[model samples]
Target: MQVELGQKIIDKIKADSLSPKPRWHFLVREWLVWMMGALALIVGAASVSVMRYLAENSSWAVQAPYGQTFAGWLLLSLPYFWLFLLGLFLWLFYYNLKHTKRGYRYPMIYVAGIALFGSILLGLAFYTLGVGSAIDGVLGRKAPLYAHVFNPHIDFWSAPEEGRLAGLVVAHVEGEDTFRLIDRKRGEWIVTYNPRDDIFVVVGQPLRAMGTISGEQSFEAVRIMRMRPGREYFQRFGPTVISVSGSGMHRNK
Candidate 1:
């Protein structure tokens, strides 16, 4: 009876033309899974770092005058793009890890926990290396909408009509009180100020003006809050990450 059953199994295999897949095929598939999972984990780490960068650099102390509650500003200032990337990569990591050999043996909680821990660990390391600011700058330059959407510096200064205008100081005279500024809205203005206002204007500085519009393209700045000098915005976001517009400084005679 055993012989007959074995013969029947052999006959079924012959009839179906069944054959084993090459061992190398399985190896390649497993390798691919590992590669994808690793890449996903790396990207997730980057997202976390950028999130940290935004949280650290945002002007949380100044939102009160804008009538924005802490929760409201917090929501607006979030890096939505990075948040999306993190979620997408985390899912990818989990999916690829689950498909790996013996991976099914682990519980979902275990797999997710691994992803979370790895992101936190690598994210801190990347932040230490300044990857967060670098990536944010690149994205801000290449994708201008990146600033329009989630940049806290840009969002906070968007209320120009409310006497809040912010931009990079594109041009200024040596030892002079007047300077030319290009704001985030791509509006260039001639800014007149008083030196005794304790305001020092310099080229390539991100500045917030507390004044009212005086002309079609002019501003009479009462006092300017000058942030640490940074690279030009709109064209290129620098350490300050304030997006604005304008080019080539013209000496207004």
Candidate 2:
């Protein structure tokens, strides 16, 4: 009875002209699954790196002017769209990894934790290497809608009445502590400064200032920040990573 049953199964397979798939077919599928997982991890890392760039470049030390706590600033500064991308790619990474040949042995939570942790680790490395700022520069210049969406920096400094101002140095006297500027909206400003700020300015360079609106079309700067077209950005303590290669108004002292 057992012999007859086995023979019938073999006959069915032969009659249907079915043949076993080649070994490489399954191998390729396995490799593809692993590749997809790795790609997802890399992209998730990029997303995290960008988020860190925004946070570190934000007005983290200048919350006094905004009247908000550190927690409040953190909540508001987070990029929800980027956060969503991070979560989405994490899921992709987890899903692809779990489909691998030996992946089924691992618990779901283990895979997910690895995905999250790996992304964060790689993201930190990317941040330290200035990849985040470089990506930000590309997006800021290439993506037209990015300015409209990421307008916090511009909006915050536009409020000259609240002791904040930013614009390009349109004119200035050589060796003088004052300059003329035009804002993003093309409005003119007369800005007086101090040399101790360490931010040497020249015509056509955009700058940020905080102090008081001195008078009609005039302003006084208690502190000033310089923005240039490079990878070197200023931190409150000193020069650090990040830059106006895609940002403005990043220092507080």
Candidate 3:
């Protein structure tokens, strides 16, 4: 019985070797999976780039009157839809990577780690290549609806009365609390600091002010802070400026 079984195995191997093999299908499938992973990585990287661009250009810091802690503003203005898309791509990459030839030999953690690491590395490359920016510009010009859907600055200046305004300090109004501010919307406004608060004002600085909008293009600042690009929102607020003087800086409020 053992000899017969051995003979059968040998016969089976010979038969398989002689048969017309469609094993090319396996190779094709493997390449297809790899392509899917590559595509996912590309898209994930693009989404990241667009998200960074939005954060850099966002005026959310200064547009809401109800004071937003950095954390609150981040929660409100984050490009969540793009982030969701990025997550979806990463998931697809993982799924595809897991199905490739010999992929099952690895543990799930290893599979996931490779996918994540590869995607991140590819993402950084895409960002440095400016692929994201190019894609963003194209989408904005060619697909208005799509661009609007993903646009990060849609509601940056939505409300004024709540002491939110984002803009560059163009000029200090001659040693006064008032400064000329060109807001994100290209609207100019007069911003006055509260007399009791001490803050340094700098020309050409990107800034956000929280206080009250008294009239058209006029704002009374409750708090002022320099705005930075690509910084994460934190729960803690920075120290408020106390005063600015040609003689020196003062922090006593």
lDDT of each: 0.73, 0.72, 0.65
User: What tens digits encode model 3's per-residue C-alpha lDDT throughout 171-230?
Assistant: 564456787676645677888896544354666555667778888789988887655431
After TM-score superposition, the amount by which residue 10's alpha carbon in candidate 3 deviates from its true location, in angstroms, is 14
Candidate 1 structure quality by residue, lDDT tens digits, 1-253: 9999999999999999988899999999999999999999999999888788766545667656667788987777777877888989999999999999988999999999999989989998998898877777676656656655545556666566777777777776655667777776667888888887535575666677777788877888887775421222444522232332254345432
Candidate 2 residues 125-240, lDDT tens each? 99889877787767655555453354335455668888887776666665667777777667778889897864556555567788898899899988887543211221111222
lDDT of 3 at 53: 63
Full-model lDDT, candidate 3: 0.65
* Deviation from native of the Cα of residue 214 in model 1, angstroms: 6.4
Clashing pairs in 2: none
In candidate 1, residue 204 scores what lDDT?
62
lDDT of 2 at 69: 85
Candidate 3: where are CA atoms >4 Å away? Answer: 1-19, 58-66, 144-148, 163-253
Instruction: Report lDDT (Cα) of residue 134, candidate 1.
Output: 79
What would the TM-scores of all predictions be? 0.74, 0.77, 0.55
Return the candidate ranking by TM-score, descending: 2, 1, 3
Better of 1 and 2 by lDDT: 1
User: Best candidate per lDDT, number?
Assistant: 1
